[model samples]
Target: MTYIRTVLGDIEPADLGPTYAHEHLVIDGGRPVELYPDFDLSDVDRAVAELAPARDLGLACVVDAMPCSAGRNVRKLVEISRRSGVHVIAPSGLHLAKYYAADLWSERGSVDELAERFRADIEDGIDEHDYLGPVVERTEYLAGVMKIAGSEPSLTPRERRVYEAAASAHRTTGSPILTHCSEGLGALEQVRLLADHGVDPRHVTLSHTDKVIDRGYHREILATGAFVEYDQGFRWKAGVDNGTLTLLAWLFEDGYGDQLMLGMDAARQGYWTTYGGEPGMTFLLGEFAAAMRERGIGDDAQAALFVRNPARAYAFAPVAVTAG
Candidate 1:
């Protein structure tokens, strides 16, 4: 039977209620922290504290989008989930090139080799050293999602390699694919590439696509049958036209609600109130739910965006086996 894998363990899709499709719950001491110190979300207590209010507001799950060698602390993720009483789905794949060092192993590994590492994280367990050290000591926590990122203008050679590996791992292990679309560009290209690599469109979700507001562009993306994650609901400036909300209305009116999902993508500590930030993690369920209702999005569409769509998009695809 298909199940939604969490950091603690797997659960029925119906139990995944009110999930944020993309989020950053931990970024402990990686290249991301070196470049942007605010990305250092190593404090387990603070993370539990930050998620407390959201959990109280019915936030049942969050997909931790940080992948390998980029400050993915699976142990801390498990601890946060245990303390906060929230299901957390960690990832196993790569992020943007800028998030890594110049001579990282991820840059040198072949597609098959990268796929092996990622598959191990899903089928076996996550490496305790986060795949940085010589010895790989995997813990009990397994990754639930395969994350791949593409650059703007087009996919770079390195990005393409990672995408191919992610597709391989997804095909073998049936883990759903979640991707990073830079500035919301390259989403259609990403979907097309993953499709070319034999990834089921129903099991793929392109993140940050709300950064682009054109209805036609979004329509083209939804036409391919891939899920689009919108995380900028709280980022738009006050008094200015809220492009994300407008795009949501357009897509919902056009009857593409099943392929749309929501997230906070709160990668920095400054985005959390426990770290003294505004809006906090509860904005999506509390404030944005009100905004969506005000825009005539209604209850069913909100459930699709937050509950039903994520339940389907994030669940493991059925892996096929041939009789030898």
Candidate 2:
């Protein structure tokens, strides 16, 4: 028997190849869009189209952090992966608490209940989609990681609940988690909480750290050996480039580039539509290379930033799947 072991249970880790560390297969605020009123791309169909470039670029996997009601497009995602020859990982925890509808949260009994839902997503499969609708069997749908996020200040109760559930899930099932922190405060606190609950900091990722640019915070978090994700490809309002340059330079100088991960975090239709610049991963990767080249960072450093570092942090073993 092929018994694959990880923080998240044992399974075949096939399908994931040349993966982007983060992405969204389908995200609908589910609100009426004032723009593109006639635009009708069902979540699955849209995911199929959005991923075309990744496939063409020889990207074999993408971890989609859509989570539960917000972007649990798993059925669609599986279909797309089968068609496009790409592996897609979906989130099974809470998104931003603000995105949590009050009626849903209030009606829910406690954080444990929410966690149970996540477990079901992982263990039982999302009910909205079945084989006919696009879902693979629950056993076939394995989440490589969980995901969570918080705001600028301290974490909210809802966010804390999500983290707690993530921690519990990690303990019970051994899945790692990726977090989104817009301002980067309380990341260390969250990391501590996860560690206290028995998760290794090495299995945690603090995303969007480039937004904060706090060197002290960066160093402290890295001390715990957690991965730092820099995902701001959008343009800046101040006419200055996002702090990626400064952050990268500092991390490189501090000898912490080995702990870094990169992504665009652009969940919109295109990269430039959300802001004003080139769109999608292709643009993001090119711009990052250009920026690094201008800064005299070596090609090996670039490969480490994109490849080796992420494999270490995320513990993705592409070879294991093929061997199986």
C-alpha lDDT of candidate 1 relative to the true structure: 0.93
What number of clashing residue pairs does each candidate have, in the order they appear? 0, 3
Candidate 2 shows a clash count of 3
Candidate that would win on TM-score: 1
lDDT of 1 by residue, 125-221 (tens): 9999999998999998899999889989899999999999999999999999999999999998899888999997999999999999899999999
Model 2 residue runs over 4 Å out of place are: 1-17, 28-46, 105-107, 129-140, 237-242, 270-277, 316-324
lDDT, residue 77, candidate 2: 65
How accurate locally is residue 61 in candidate 1, as Cα lDDT from 0 to 100? 95
TM-score against native, each model: 0.99, 0.79
Q: lDDT for each of the candidates?
A: 0.93, 0.63
- Candidate 2 has an lDDT of 0.63
